[model samples]
Target: MQRGKKKIKEWKLKDEDTRRQFEVKVQQKNNRNRGGWKQLSENVLEAAKEVCGESTGHRRRRRETWWWNEAVQRSLQEKKRAYKRWQRTQNEEYKREYKEKTRQAKREVARAKRLALENWSEELNSSEKQKEMFRIAKQMKRESKDVMGAKYIKDERGVIKINTEEILGRYVTLKTC
Candidate 1:
């Protein structure tokens, strides 16, 4: 169970000692008081936490921004410093500097993204990267199928035929045609 998203623990049921300790704690709770289902469940969870350990329930994720280099980092840092200076002093010059820095950082980030995409496209055009391109295409196709689920017939005005009678009428017209 999650509590404030700070810690998450699961029962170490595979370990014999953990299982025994959990059982003992649960039994002690059950004997100490005759409580409602909520109390009982809370006790069980407490016992499990004592036996098990907490986890953030996070896995390693791939970084999408492969083109994030030192230049982009420096630009962002400069922008942040300018913004902080402006915030602290509330000076017009500082504010202008912050705005300029923000624009420069945004341009840098956009340029990096464009360059990375171009490089990736170039690599994909090479014969050796054909397999990679096909793999990406297949993955995109699979994702599209998952997103665009259950295609339905639409009328000429582009409204979906929701009623059974309307669907049957459309089917009849199609068969006749």
Candidate 2:
């Protein structure tokens, strides 16, 4: 037996209708095998050129050259310099305002403290009892001494040292006249 089926004979068209049908089938097959629109357009153009003729001088122009202008660059530099100057002025103004605000606050606090001391002095001097109480409080502070981690009474030549414990405790003593 022949190794391969002896190269199958090519089909020959016998009529115009058969030839037209064969061409239609080939075109459909070609369309199915084609890619997207760009590829299809390229294939169609190539086929058109084969059937018709090719055109010339259909090329795109080169793009224009671009460079930075000296004047524009200088203007940009000036704008940046002006911005820095304005920023410096604004920062100085902010610092000045902050200092003035802090100075005002300090002045208010000093005035309030002075007025409070004046009122307290007036209250302390208003009544004789208040004055006596203040004197007694001062005397008590001068005489008190810590003894054995507690305040106690001590006598020196009949002078009594009275503290919290001695003042609060009750005592009884007998005397003959």
Candidate 3:
């Protein structure tokens, strides 16, 4: 069975022509297949693919915004409401209110972020939180690294290391040096 069976665009089946095409394809394949369940299953999958498109499985990466809180949400909502009101009326008073709300929202978000970072730093300072500290450090490192950049590990000759063995050798050589 194909891994992305669920990824098939089922909405295409809503169209009558598409449904007819799928049914015809399945019927044509069925007449040729004398084999049991396996052949029928394969024919159905092939029909589905030809009728509806499949997703490539690539998805967008969502960033972790751990600092977001209730205050930020409320401020952002107020800003959005003000902005809509200003857009609807084009009045100077409403525009000014929208600007003020935008600024307030920004301030709240910044404050929340600062507080979160401070809390993380405090946790890192505590001996008991060593495991949590390392986990956070690893997550931060993973987030900060450029996906398209070359590997950071280098040999003693200053050549960038690529392979796992070479990278390990570079680390071992560094410890000795």
Instruction: Tell me each candidate's RMSD, in Å, in order.
Output: 12.5, 44.1, 14.7
Which digits, one per residue and each the tens of the lDDT, describe model 3 over residues 1-177?
A: 234323666667865799999999999999988689999999998899889977665464333377988999999999999999999999999999999999999999999999998987787766866887788789999999878965578776778888999898888887888
Give the candidate order by descending lDDT. 3, 1, 2
Q: Model 1 scores what on Cα lDDT?
A: 0.80
Q: How far does residue 80 in candidate 1 sit from its true spot (Å)?
A: 1.0
Lowest-scoring 10 consecutive residues by lDDT in candidate 1? Answer: 2-11
Greater lDDT among 2 and 3 belongs to 3
Q: Which candidate tops TM-score?
A: 1
- Error (Å) of candidate 3 at residue 147 is 7.9
Reference-based TM-score of each model: 0.46, 0.24, 0.44
lDDT, residue 111, model 3: 99
Write out the backbone clash pairs for model 3: none
Tell me the spans in candidate 2 whose CA falls farther than 4 Å from its real position.
Answer: 1-90, 128-177
lDDT of 2 by residue, 1-177 (tens): 223322211222333464565556546546776787777666644444443333332344332212223444454455555556656786776555555555555555566567656655675766864876689799998789554463544443444547655434322111221
Clashing pairs in 1: none
Q: 22 in model 3: Cα distance from truth in Å?
A: 46
